[model samples]
Target: MRFARTRRDPVEVNLTPLIDVVFLLLIFFMVSTTFETRQALELELPETTSGAAAEVSPVTLVVTAAGVYRLGERELTPAELASALAAEAEQAREHGLVVEADGRASHADVVRVLDQAGLQGIERVRIATTESRTGETISPQAETP
Candidate 1:
């Protein structure tokens, strides 16, 4: 008696589906990844016409029309404001001072602040103003603080 030999077929694996799934995952991750743009503190910066961008973090003083003064988030009296300015000036003379005065704030109050800043030997002082709807500086009468 003789036995017949059967035909053998080659085995194969299809990788097209696996490759497609991997490609879809790569695209999904790429599209879902978020990029951070800002890493510093947020501030409502005042606009200026001729002033160039500030390079250093200067001691900022905010004055309201009611003659209220603020250093950071805390309210400061005239004396405290002057002393703070002097201390900051002593720490880093290169870092100047910036004064943000409201439109209705009195000129006398601004002058007084300037005088205090000068007493602290802070020569580089600037006034903060917001831009108009037209994208131009609202033009505070005095260019410098």
Candidate 2:
């Protein structure tokens, strides 16, 4: 008796499901991820239980109600302030900046100071704020610097 032979088909892998699952995972992560942006300076009042303080005092930049720039105790014009900051930054003190704006200081003045600080290679800049008895922060009033 003669036996008949049958042809066999080659095995193939369908990658559509794998690709779809991968894309789904990508979409899931994209949707689940969180993004935070700091559009302004962050200022937090010192708590009663705050940690130990550093020995070095940060560079102080004061914006008076009259919109004058004071680097430490010395008052400086905008141009002078920039030059002074550049010089100080070259020292590489690794200290941040403390910005204390008067209650009547203008917002523009504060932002300008911040911008200048950034340009002078200052990495950290803080806004000095006061805490009320009610646990609320009181920002300075708006006045042209």
Candidate 3:
């Protein structure tokens, strides 16, 4: 007597569940992530004892120690800066302007930025500064150039 051979079905892996799980994880990560916008320049801002954190502004100008000017993330020449400021003047006046100058940057350079802003009719301008470590306030009249 010969025994009959039994045929079995081929094994298949169901990837639908795996795909669904992966999709859920991706959505979870995307929803939980926080995004922050930061400037490209590296600036060690000057410190002041009475310094206060400033609110975010639509216009931000960065002045480097080498007298380089950056409007937002874009580097601008002194001449180009004037035109750029003119373009953003409306927004700057509405949302205000924040000037972030390096600790070693020249006072003239900072003044130039302020003057440009003044000419644009942006009355609300704030200088960005860090808090002093010594906890002592220095008066502007006490400092000698």
lDDT of 3 by residue, 13-122 (tens): 99999999999999999999988875342334455575444457778888999999999888987778789899899998888878877889998888788778878898
Q: Who wins the TM-score comparison? A: 3
In model 2, where is the ten-residue run with the lowest total lDDT?
136-145
**Worst ten in a row by lDDT for model 1:** 136-145
lDDT of 1 by residue, 21-60 (tens): 9999999999999977754323344554664444434467
Give residue 57's error in model 1 in angstroms.
3.0
Residue-wise lDDT of candidate 2 within 29-126, one digit each (tens)?
99999878668655454444433323333577789998899887789887787787776775423756667787799998888887887787776565
User: Each candidate's lDDT (Cα)?
Assistant: 0.69, 0.68, 0.74
Query: How would you order the candidates by TM-score, starting with the best?
Result: 3, 1, 2
TM-score of each: 0.53, 0.51, 0.55
lDDT of 2 at 79: 71
Model 1 stretches astray by more than 4 angstroms: 1-56, 134-145
Residue pairs clashing, model 2: 67-145, 103-141, 106-143
Compared with the true structure, model 1 gives a TM-score of 0.53
The model with the greatest lDDT is: 3
